[model samples]
Target: MNNFIKNLLLSNFNKLLQSTKIACPKENLHNSNRLKFYNPGKVTYDGKLNCGITSYLTSFMLSYHNIDHKVWLSKYGFGDYLEDHVHITTNSGLLIDTTYRQFFIDYRSDGNCDYYKYLFETCEPIFVGSPNEFDLLKKSIERQNIKVFGSLNQDIKELSDFWKQDINITPKMNLYDMRKSNEIHPTLLVEIPSLIQPLIT
Candidate 1:
């Protein structure tokens, strides 16, 4: 079955490459041509999990959508933007962050939620990953129209729930992340990026 899928992907890769659109920082794009792949590091709004699945997924989705963005990793190495929430452009682009709690619950104070509120009201943010986070995001938004994307597969029960709802979930597969490590080639484990080709095309 895997071989069949691989063959199908290989056969249609050209079409996917052509149809797909990716936007990246101009500097990154120029560098991308020279490097074998992109290796975006993990980051968050606070000095918490310097790395996370959400951080990596953000870069992956950007690559998937063909969009380039620079995450403001403050010089102090903490994305305190959640606390110091500021106005930002939304229509042209957005910022993304992922967390386990539903609706910024771990935030030490109302400031964090306020920041998210600002983000929702101003530059619409597109958040994805973790079902708990999604539930919180909706409730906090107040405005029923705010939209965020999320998913998780931590246990069989969750998977069963997802299946029961007939939600659009992708089958998991290993691909590659261009991030370099000491022993491994920069490429790390990744979901099947090529899978989107069929959905998009």
Candidate 2:
């Protein structure tokens, strides 16, 4: 992707991100223990909470704009066994994750989480910039010998279908409708249902 197109995609992305209703629950924000995660001066919401919803909105934006991309589903690093996270890898060579702060705030700080270090390369609010960077993150996961599903390639429609079932959202829902809904917490959506998995032999 040329600089012009990349810049344009980035511009659109920032606009959508700013317009989207991403937020932290008021109660959580008030909790002394969880207070640090919600920075009132910058964004009142929690990044960890918006991870999934923001990803799909981002992917669809790319598709509609004629930008080629692949949505990647990964183990959320913090969830019930059925959980997985979503992100985008654009053909233009950009790796996107709008809610990366969530990873650090949600898991990295917990020293009691013995497996936390193994789950992610850095929970320090950094993003994977390119496919090569993404691969490094994957390598880190492998080096730790984690058994989680690192990431699976998926189509937009498949993810949309999952959302429809998980949150009464429609597959054909447009970006405008999605943005109008303000915020749809990922916690309310289940990525892959256990029933959808085939039994092992």
* Model 2 regions lying over 4 Å from their true place: 2-14, 22-46, 76-80, 106-128, 134-201
Q: Give the TM-score of candidate 2.
A: 0.43
List the candidates' TM-scores in order.
Answer: 0.26, 0.43
Report the number of clashing residue pairs per model: 11, 2
Candidate 1: which stretches are off by over 4 Å?
A: 1-53, 75-91, 100-103, 106-201
Residue 193 shift from truth in candidate 2, angstroms: 31
After superposition of all CA atoms, the RMSD between model 2 and the true structure is: 13.1
lDDT of 1: 0.29
Candidate No. with top lDDT: 2
